[model samples]
Target: MGEFDLIARYFTRPVRRAALGVGDDCALLSVTPGMQLAVSSDMLVEGRHFFADVDPAHLGHKALAVNLSDLAACGARPLAFTLALALPRVDAPWLQAFADGLLRLADAHQCELVGGDTTQGPLNLCVTVFGEVPTGQALLRSGARVGDDIYVSGTPGEARLALDALRGRLALPPAALQQLRPRLEQPTPRVALGLALRGVASSAIDVSDGLLGDLGHILKASGVGACVDATVATNLLAASAQQAVATADFGAQTLMQCALAGGDDYELVFTAPPAQQAAVQAAAQASGTRATRIGRVEPAPGLRVVDGQGQPVAQHFASFDHFA
Candidate 1:
């Protein structure tokens, strides 16, 4: 099929939330009064972001999901998104499945697909998502303060565990791999939790590039240090995955590494003051997402990981950096 035909057949739809959708040169969006536009873009290249044989549907869900994660971190509600896709060749089944997954998630969050471009090239998907939050109410990395309790939403590290298993860096049973695959392939963007955190979280960020690394952005911006309880953080791994790791002969340190440095989690690692601790839990409960307190912000400046006994754990875990 031709370019326009491909787009119409797969990606095009009647946009309920956008001013103008496909067939326009530019999509128009109207921001609510007293609200600011929150925009984020994410790109996924075939080999770098996903395996060659990955399900197209999952790819579609993730392409937009990652960008939504950015909005979630900012405490914005997703409004719409534009997709730019490059394909090596037109594969009807692949496009159909991809569009299905992409639009499904979009519909779930009331995020409309408004406009985009399709081109000939290696398979690549880029999504630019738009969201809105009340002026001056958007969560930011610079808002963290000393004594703020560090919290993370949902489970982290399962995605990295899945990746390690797939890459042969670690051994896991087939059942374990099957169970963990969804964590890596299809991450749920914490939009509700973010919305709930509007005035609750002091500083917020999505845990895309490992928990520690993403949390570091908040630390640097807020000019504060943190002491994470390693035991708490490591135990944040889902129970099944923890059992799998143990069965595979990996120890607590390895689990700590995965839980701390595992990227692609797409969960939120945020901060809130001690006084707001009750409010934070209320937010979590309202959103029906589990939020765990793993650490606290300190007046000093760097990230410190400590064991249950308050003894420091010696280790270095780096987050993902495209250029580094």
Candidate 2:
């Protein structure tokens, strides 16, 4: 089919008043009057983002979700998006499922799919998401300060573990496999909670390149350092410890490695002043999302992971590298 046929068949649809809806070079949106646009772009490449055989529907969800996660890091509310898709051929079934997944997220988040280009090439998807936050109020990596508490949302490393299972490094029960597949394939973008954090979080970034590496972005941007207690940050592994140990497995350590270095978690990592800690906690509780304090910002200018006795561990940058 042709471009116009594809648009009418899948993308064009009615949207809420906040979004002017499709059919333009750019989408028109009305945000809170004085806010500035908060925009982010992400690209997903086949074989890198997913196996060639992975489900198209999940792939589509992830391409958009990752971009939305970037906007969330800036505490921006969803406005609209543009998608640029490159495919080897126009497989109707694949396009249908992909569009279904994209529309599902757009409708839920109230973002209209405005415009994009389609071309002949290896499979790749790029999405640019638009959002808005009050002027001078967008949460940024540079705003972290000494004495700020570092926090992360939801559990980490599950996606990486899912990858391990996919690669046959470990065996997962059918139920566990089903549970992890969605997380590995399609992650939820924490938009509402992130927008709720505006004015509350001092600095923010999503865990796109694992916790340690992504946190390093905040440290570098803020011109500060951090000391993360791996003990606390690795607590999520405790939940699976029984099963891991019972199976005579190193699953716990694997999970830790994944949490520390695996990209694609897409959960938010943020800092807040100690004084606002209570307020941040209350907000997360109200939203029914778990936000855990995993570390603290320091005046020194290096990233360090310390043991209980405050001794430093050997560290190496172990996250995803786009050009590696």
Candidate 3:
């Protein structure tokens, strides 16, 4: 099939939230009176981001989901998105499945697909998502303050566990691997949690790059230090991963590395003041997601990991870096 034919057959759709949709040269969006537009872009290349044999449908879901996570970090409600897709060759079945997955998630959040480009090249998907937040209520990395309680939404590091198992670096039972695969392949973007945290969270960021690295962004931006309870953070792994961890004999250090630095977790890592702890929990409940308090912002200027007894743990975990 030709480019335009492929786009029309798979991606064309009516606009619900956008002024102009797929066929147009540009998508037009109107912001609410007191809200500001929030925009983020994410790119996924075949081998770097996903396995060669991954499901096309899951790839579609993930391409957009990662971009949505950025909006979630800013406490924005997803409105619309534009996709720029590149394909090595036209496969009708693959395109159909991909479009189905991408549009399904878009429909769930009322995010419309706007305008984009399709080209002949190695498989790649780039999505630029648009959202909106109250003019001054958008959560930012610079807003965290000393004494703020550091909270993480949902289970972090589960994706990393899935990654290790898939890469053969860790061995796991088939059942355990099956249970953990979704966490890696199809992550749930915590959009509701972000919306609920608008005024409650002092500073917020989605944990895309391992917990420490992403949280480090908030710390550096806010000019504060943090003491993360390693025990508490490590215990946040999902049950399946915990089971896999037990069987792998990967030792405490490897476990800590995955739990603390495993990237690709789209969960939110945010901060709120001690007084807002109740509110934060309320928000978590209201959003139908779990939020755990794992640490506290401190006057010191670097991230420190400590054991449950308040004794420091000597270890370093680095997050994903494209250049490094």
What lDDT does each candidate get?
0.91, 0.82, 0.89
Candidate 3, 1-324: lDDT as tens digits: 899999899988877777778886676788889999999999999889999899989999999899999999999999999999999999999989999989899899999888899999999899999999989999999999999999998878788888898999888778788888888888999999999999999999998889999999999999999999987768767454666545655556766787789999899999998999899999999999999999999999999999999999988888899889
Clashes per model (N, Cα, C within 3 A): 0, 0, 0
TM-scores for all candidates?
0.97, 0.93, 0.97
Model with the higher TM-score, candidate 2 or 3: 3
lDDT top scorer: 1
- Worst ten-residue run, lDDT, model 2? 240-249
Clashing pairs in 2: none
State, as a TM-score between 0 and 1, how close model 1 is to the true structure: 0.97
TM value for model 3: 0.97
- The all-Cα superposition gives candidate 1 an RMSD in Å to the true structure of 1.3
Query: Each candidate's root-mean-square deviation in Å?
Result: 1.3, 2.1, 1.4
Better of 1 and 2 by TM-score: 1
Using lDDT as the measure, name the better of candidate 1 and candidate 3. 1
lDDT of 2 by residue, 1-324 (tens): 987787778777776654556676666667678999898988889888899998888888888899899988898888889888888988899999999888888778877787788888999899999898889989999999999999998777778777887889877665666676787799988887788788899999999889999999999999999998776656664454334344435454565687677778889999999999888888688767789998899999988887556887565548777886
Task: Between candidates 1 and 2, name the one with more favorable lDDT.
Answer: 1
Positional deviation of residue 178's Cα in model 1 after best superposition, in angstroms: 1.2
